[model samples]
Target: MKHLAERARQVIPGGVNSGQRSIPGLTDLVITHAAGARFRDSQGREFVDYHAAFGPPLLGHNDPDVSAAVAEAGRTVDLCGVGVTAGEVELAETLAELVPSVEKVLLTSTGSEATFHALRVARAATGRRLVVKFQGCYHGWHDAVSLNVISAPEKVGTHDPISTGILPEVLQATLVLPFNDAEAVRRAFAEHGDDIAAVILEPVPHNVGCLLPEQEFLETLRAECTRAGSVLIFDEVITGFRHHLGGWQAISGITPDLTTMGKAIANGYPVGALGGRADLMELFSSRPGGPAFFAGTYNGQPAVVAAALATLRKLREEPVHEHVFRLGERIRTGLAEVFASLDIPALVTGYGSVFVGYFMTGPARTYDDLLRNDANMFIGYRRRLLEHGVFELPLNLKRSHVSYAHTDADADHLLEAAASAASLARGDVLDLTDASTMGGADAHR
Candidate 1:
């Protein structure tokens, strides 16, 4: 809270570039280094990390294998023209083999760019103008995806948020619908079927602390999109490798026409991809007779490409789903126990390795339901947890992704922190033993 904030505030807007980073948690220590499950902050405080860099870092920070792969790739043939690279071409094939829906892959720098290009492809392929997206689910800061992202619940009732700094007309071609309600999706199609190009969404909405939809609802969405001739795009950037090797779409038996993925594809390295039915993906692939050309200088940098290949190969070998599922269950149960003690009605949402904690009694099925949950409780817990040497993504609404690095022991420590913080939140602020176990104990003063 000393030189970190003062120095950062002098240079960076809002004291940080990303909105989540500036959140006041435990003296707002800036991290200097991280390994497996632990990170050492600039203030020299050590903490168990669960934020995982906004759903990346699935293999944990600075994985030696991934780091080594990147270094070797860089030292070998660092620069490749936008034309082609054997490394990227092989990585694309690997993606196709892993994600059945993707017959070909178009590389991109981040989830937003992938979605942007995917939307353009969908429009060209379908010959339509409007697009549909679920409310509260984030697809990055790009115009189409950012509309109606969030409005803090009390301000609006299931409408586009505008989010400030965005041109109002930018959202004119976009339609925001309530998530997990098949009726709403159906109604959109019924009204604007002919004009729609794509219905894009995160197959698992981890953006809002992991708001999962009804299975039937997801099925119905796929069905409606098909009937309306609109492309169905699954933004599986977070859930692809984290949920399962293929993703939630595979588990739910829903196939999207276009799918975008990032985050865990290269562990912590920056990499992203968009792919689906070859016919649709070809819209972006340059053609002799067609008008689409997707190319970038750093689209498939060799280092990141190598990292993705190595990370995916490891996942293929170990198959981490089973153990992560168990860990997720234990964490949910443990957190439930904490909330129970505090006389608060709460539960964790999403698949194993991803979770959203809610403080409401109602089941959070839609964006609105998730929006109504306890923000104050989350902020309170976040402050206490960080002070106790646990790092989170700051705000209550963001999804927290777990990684292979977090053990059952780490889960136990987290549960203890949640329980202690819940007490603080309820105004009881009970004195607990072993406060020193969580670093930054001086933060409370």
Candidate 2:
């Protein structure tokens, strides 16, 4: 595993394509194979996979039904970008039926592309230049909506770029505000309501450990956007089908004007979709004078569309949501019990299949609240758990997820590993001969 990563680094910029995959100590072990709830690393070490490929393995890795559908579609389908296929039509119809806000759908190749196009459509429809996005709610890595996610609390309203190479004008056009805070929304819209093209957010902001929106907060945003004639967009790349069969907007009962979906929607396939109101979406139509421009060579590749169709069908047939939610609840309760028994100052947060362990005493309500967590300690604990064959994301501040394949036995194994990891984090050292001195160290440890 070490040799493979070292060789990969010679060619790949960071030994990994994505920054989050570059775990400090564990990046050496490249995954060789995955199936069901567990996967094997290049070193032939097997671990229960809680990362679930960052929340896309809804039915677990290498699901036979999904794989079979993709295989069949690939064999029969011709080259992409030729024209529309039956699979594309079927998948589009499925999306429109599932997502309450989707009257029409435009397929893309990734979540970032979906969001980029959604913003373009919104700006064109409203004839506005400014966009409003909440802090800690990651839409994607696109330049327009990428600012302010994972920024320091002190930098909440700064509208600074989280990455390099972003245009200064892009920063000026976007207004970054606090999540779950209605007053922030009111203030931004009050000052520049007519100039705001759209207000986008993850209904349940999963980028910061699944921060659920307050009912009144979502309601206020919806009302404000309606009054201001700004588009309301829900970036559900992480929460689309994980929370429910439909998007989170359906369960929350606050419909957005546009919604972006990816990740689990295709069950690990490369697919993204921007779906929304018919009138706004029609701007992409080839009416010779249509307003919004939208194009992608691999937008509706048959194999990806087939895989998504099969995955959604399986989700409908099986109790995937109910099962995963039950498992997530079990893991949450078990972790709380383990932390209490170990006397660790920690909290298990999130809803449905998503959760995170914040090394803090209280619930995490906002990005600022998460700042109180001991991030280094949390990463240390995660590394310790990794050593014991439990694989949550080794990166700090990312959410852990459960797939449909995760069972009660897997949950038990994770809790057992976590108990030991927490003990290790506290440096539980014992010295029988020096009992008197042990009390001094005990207080702080």
Candidate 3:
């Protein structure tokens, strides 16, 4: 593993393609392959996967149905960038049918692209510049929304960009506020209502563990955006298709102007979608006087579209949500029991099919409340779980996903591992030399 890590570092920056993939101090795992709920590393160690590739493998890694669809699509169709394919039309129609607010849809290669275009549509439609995003909700790696997620105490209310190269003007255009604070939303809109083009957020901020949005806060956003004529965008890249086929908007019943979706939409295939009212989405049309521009070579690549269609069909036909949601609840309850038995100060929280164990006291309503979390213990416990053949990212506040492929037996095994990991964490027996230094706020999805 160490040799492979070193080899990757020689070619790839930080030994991983994505920044979050590089584990601090520990040598990162070179995953050989994955199927269903388990994956094996280069060292021949098999672990029950809860990471779910950062919430993309909703049906599980290498799901046969999605793979078969991709294979069939490859045989019939490939990328034809100039014209649209039957698969692309099917995907857009399916999204419109499933999502209440989405009358039209646009495909993109990744979630980041979906968000980037969504913002463009919003700005073009409203003729405004500023965008409002919450503190801990991660939209993507884009400059407009890539700041202040999982921030430190000192940087909480300040303009904290996750990366360095973001222009000062880009940072200044975003208004970052705390999640679940309805009053803050009211205040921001009251002060800068006309200037704000959009207010984007994850209905559930899964990136920083699941900080569920308050009803009042969501209502306030809808009302303010409606009154100000600002586009309301729901960045459901994490929550979409995982919680429901229609996304969180279906469950919340508070429709937004636009919705950005990906991650679980394709069962690990690189495909994302931005969908909304026809009036706003038509702005992307290259008509004679269309305001917004949207173009991508791989936007509706055949295989990816097939994979997404297959994944969505399976979610609709099978009891995927029922099974995964049950397992998620089981894991959350079991973890709470384990921590309580060990007398550890921890909180187990999540929505359907997602769970996070935070080493903090009581309910965490906002990112500011999460600052009290025991970062070292959170990292150490997850590391111990990794040793016990339960694979979760060794990053504090990173949530675990329960996929449709996961069974009751898998959940039981994870609970057993969690019990042992919690015991180890309580005893302070794990070597947390580097874990202590890996700040909770630095690593995000």
Q: Which candidate is the best by lDDT?
A: 3
Task: Report the alpha-carbon TM-score of model 3 versus the true structure.
Answer: 0.96
The list of candidate 3 runs beyond 4 A from truth reads 286-288, 429-445
> What local distance difference test score does each model get?
0.76, 0.82, 0.87
Give lDDT tens digits, candidate 2, residues 115-179. 88889999999999998888777777778876766665567668756677998988889888888
Candidates, ranked, lDDT: 3, 2, 1
Worst 10 residues of 2 by lDDT: 436-445
lDDT of 1 at 215: 89
**Model 1 lDDT per residue over 192-211, tens place:** 99999999998766766767
Candidate with top TM-score is 3
TM-score, every prediction: 0.91, 0.94, 0.96
lDDT of 1 at 292: 62
Winner by TM-score between candidate 2 and candidate 1: 2
> Per-residue alpha-carbon lDDT of model 3 for 64-173, expressed as tens digits?
99999999999998887787899989999999999988998989988888889999989998889999999988888889988888777899999988788999999999
Residue 392's lDDT within candidate 2 is 80
